[model samples]
Target chain A: MLRINNLHVKIEGKQILNGLDLTVNAGEVHAIMGPNGSGKSTLSHVLAGREGYEVTDGQVLFNAENLLQLSPEQRAHKGVFLAMQYPVELPGVNNMTFIRESINAIRRARGQDEFNTLEFLQLIREKAAQLQLDEKLLKRNVNAGFSGGEKKRNEVLQMAMLEPQLAILDETDSGLDIDALRVIAQGVNSLRSAERSIILVTHYQRLLEYIQPDFVHVLVNGRIVRSGDKQLALTLEQKGYNWIIEEDAA
Target chain B: MKSPVQNAQLQTPQQRQQLQREWFQQLVVGAEVDAEYDPDWLLPLREKALQSISTLPLLNRKQEAWRYNRVDNIFQNSFDPLFDNDLEQKICIEDIGLPAIDSYRLVFINGRIDLSLSELSELPAGVILTGTAEALRTIPDQLMSSFDHLHQPGEQLFTALNTALFNDGVYLHVNQSVTLDRPVEIIYLNNNLTRSEQHVGSMIQTRNIIDLESGASATVIEHFISNNKHEKYFHNNFTDINLADDSRLRHYRIQDESRLAYHLSNVQITQHRRSRYFSTCLAFGGLWSKSAVRVEFQAQQAECDLLGLYTVGDQQLTDFHLDVQHRVPSCRSSEQFKGILYGRGRAVFDGRILVDRQAQHSDAALTNDNLLLVRDAEVNTKPQLEIYADDVKCSHGTTVGRLDPEQLFYMRSRGIAEHSARKMLCQGFATDIIESFELQQLRDYASEKIAHTLNSVESEMEHKNGH
Candidate 1:
């Protein structure tokens, strides 16, 4: 469902992602483990078509369409979702209103009828129950004054509602406790399907214990130095990225 | 209808200036000292005001207060200050969500007060609510003290002009130790019949000089609105408020005039010992509008809250100038003004908080936040704090930024389009002040109006782009 060929991107005239290549098919959960400044977040931003990142080289194809050519919102309409590392607080935009508008936008862009308020509320209730999210939070402003755990859960709730074709969870487990981590993983596990793909980007391997990715890739200095099955995650958890560097040097 | 040339000639600049202040000067011309109420104190004050109006000249763009607003277009409007004595105009008094009390509501149309709609007898026994003309006749002694207290005649050109030619407006005074449950609503409507500008100057003053014998409270809603959106009109207003010891007053001004109208207003408030004052200024319409509010805390333990919200679009221009003075010890003052400028619209906010010497332990802050939606739009923001007291906490901040990129991306990733997401962000930006209103109905009404404003602007842009 997604393909990246030698993607090299630069931000603020400094190279962040250099010749990074990855691929993911439908119905698969892929985990990218990297230390700080390994271009993990940059890769997610590039895939989501965020502006200000100049593409120095290569192409990112999502379902055979060049993803880099679309605007951020247009990329969103194409079922590409990026869960931010730090969720920005929007004090006046109601969570429910934003979700409904976003759902309607994607639906309309895909030649589908929009959901009315009643129908949208019904869908929201179901999603809220699945994600263990407080329904009152939907009525309040989007993540305004929200705790770290609540913001992460809210992101998952959005993912469950929009039901994106490719969900990129960027450092979703950074600030979450064990309970929040399990809740977030449960939300992601609930949305797993044959027609959708998931990318779990994290610095630690603990999240992989809950989501259980089918494939794991080690990112070092903006390049994927190693790729393997779930065991690679356990190795990284035990030995960390230094072992990977030692192996690469050998 | 038969003489088009004559009609065109009558709309000249000299004809427009002739209608400036008819009833105002007539009050001065027919001055009679009543034994019951003396006009002695106001005579010299009036003479000084007339001289000030004549010497200071009219507002020009060179002046900072009139920046981004056109005073020339407003001056070209011909006004009729003569009172309509027949009392034939309709009086419509309908409640629109604001609380109602036994307080009398004086309605004015085309600068004429309709006394028939007022119910002054129902007010509390000691309270006084009457027209300025009637107060001059019956209780001139009480009016003489507070008439020109805060509104210095020559200090402001418009107020000077209004004072030199003043006429019928509401005169309200709440007795000491009286706490009113409902607010006094003064409805000022501009019913312009000709293409000329509608000019109005209303004043409110207290009686008896009783300094609110401890714990007096009152609320006032002054609404200045115009019905005709297509006419070239002007509404220049001035309000002077004096809060005595341990007294509290909540003043709200809602200005929704015509887009072709030029609206200028100035509010000067002075707080005595232990007095608290809250003022909210909301401006939503006009081709060009400017408002200046100056609050002076004259005594110790006084507090002042100054809040303003303005939205401008198209070729519209809006300006808000606030000057807060903490002149005494332990006085606290805060000023927050937020606005959104879209299209080629321009908005300027200049606020100053001054803490004088001996005003120790004074806490003063000023915040100005603006959002620019279009590239062509402009916003000039300056928040200043001049503190002379060493032991004072004074801070000021000004933010001129676009919508947060991360917030926008989060909304879009949820499926909202770019335009709807932008509108929602803008709504959130201004909701901080709208929610500050304690009244639920008022907050909801403000929220709905803000929503409609954003949606209409979006639709207008869409329509303009269709061509």
Candidate 2:
């Protein structure tokens, strides 16, 4: 469903990603594990087409279409989703109104009919209920004054609303408690299907205990140094990335 | 409305002072309290004001004009007008948050003009962009004549007070058939921080006069700002504009002062035959700000457009009194004023347009709308149209409303677009007026400031709710 080849990214003239390669097929769940400053978030941001990043040498393909040439909104229209590490606070803008506009814009770009008001309300309410987010929270500004757990769940709620084909959850478990982790994992589990793929990017192996991944890749220095099955996560949790770094150095 | 006190040939300061002394002695005004700080030319006017008030009848409830006004509202104030802070240190134009656009820039801090910060040395020929002090020295007769149509001292005491003690302001005159290539920016920054601790409030009175001769055109932006956040002061500003036949003037004003300041402003504009006047006023600051705008159409084929936007929050009050008069036939005028009230903010808008019987074929429309963001906020708006012309088309409308509860209840949207959301929020109410601004940078800056204010109010509300 997605491919990244020789992705070398730099931010403000400092290289972050160096010759990274990764590929995921349909219905595959991949767990990308790395320590701090290991370019894990960089991969997610690059895929989402955020500005201020210079991709000196890289190629990204989504469904065999060049993704680097598209704008951020165009990437979203093509079913590329990045659950941000820190969801931005948008004051004054109504949360629901923004979501509706985003959905309609993407739908319009995809040549699909926009959702009716009543239909949209019903759909959003059902999805929000499944994630255990209060209906009152849906009324507030997007990510404005939201708690850490609430922010994670809100990201999950948006993911459910957009229903993208390739969803990358970036550091979703970084600040969440166990209950929030379980709720988010459950939401992701329910959305998984034969045609949908998910990339769970994290620094710890705790999130994998809730939702099992088919593949585990340890990314160090912008490149995947090791790839194995779900058992690889357990092994890395026992022996931290320090040993892996030493191994890479050796 | 022209005054009959027409005198000329007082060419020097001493000559004008002598003439004022002669007039003062002839008036036989006896009620004199200390006048050491008063200027020679203004002493006579102040005494004339006192004489006019002393000759008035006692106040009565039956009097329509005095029905609601207290004597103290006009004549009472503790603010001193003698806090002269001669700050010679020049500051950059960008330090005040105004873009350094290519224009004639005038900067005044503490009522004193800063030549180092001003860019008026290279004005085009036939254009005069100067301070009121220089104008008084050069064209005292013309400057005083511009205010001939103003209300008498007994009628509007604040205006008379301004005339009696106006420190400094802008004076721009475009000669016949001349067109200014760029707009003139007059920035007034009142920051008497040294006296704020002493509980002494300084009074800042500024008067501006703009004259456009026949077939002349110019644009002027008057910006009032306060540097210290907790500055305590009183600002009274009066502006007079005159457009001759076939002349045009676009006047834009912005008042973003400290919340602890009290502000009063009056703008009087007169349009002659076939002249055009466009005014955009944004009132976003000051604890208690009151503005009165009057536009008069004196001849046929004249047009005027008035646009105002005001936002008040948290113990703030903003009042606007708009009056438009169409005295000639085939004249046109339209006015739109919008307000945003949040967090116990109070706003009052009283707009009135009068079309005389001689003003046949006059087209006029006035609308005032207010958006209340909180239940505790208040907005009182009234738009009145009194048309005596049978062949005129006049309509007036006013609305005081809140944000849609039903729409705000559905804030959980699909993944959001921050830029689009902010634009949409500002577009909901402010787009109409902000878009009408002909300057691109000014429009964009206003939009960004509105967004910043919205965020601040929202966060403040959240903190209140949290407590």
Best by DockQ: 1
Q: What DockQ does candidate 1 have relative to the true complex?
A: 0.61
The Cα error of candidate 1 at residue B39, in Å, is 4.9
lDDT of 2: 0.78
A1-250: candidate 1 lDDT, tens digit per residue: 8999999999999999989999999999999998899999999888887778999999999999999888788888888998888888887777887788788888899999999989999999998888788888998898988889999999898888889999999999998999989988999998999999999999999998899999999998888999999999998888889988787778
| Local distance difference test scores for all models | 0.74, 0.78
Residue pairs in collision within model 2: A95-B411, A95-B413, A96-B411, A96-B412, A96-B413, A99-B413, A99-B414
Q: Model 2 chain B, poorest ten-residue lDDT window? A: B1-10
Q: Which segments of model 2 are wrong by more than 4 Å?
A: A1-250, B1-47, B53-77, B88-90, B152-155, B193-197, B409-411, B416-427
Model 1's alpha-carbon lDDT is 0.74
Model 2, B343-364: lDDT tens per residue?
6878888787989989999999
- lDDT of each residue in B1-467, candidate 1, tens digit only: 01112332355555433422322343334333222332666667666876765455445456666554544444433333344334345545653333343445766664456666655556765566666667777777866655564343222666765555555566767777788666676776665434322333212211212223346787776766664666444555666567888899877777776677666676777788888888777788887777777888888999988887888888888888888888889999888889887768889898978888889999988899888877888887877678888998888888888888877776765667667888889888888788766666567767776788888878887887893
Pairs that collide in candidate 1 are A102-B415, A102-B416, B24-B165, B24-B166, B37-B141
- In candidate 2, clashing pairs total 7
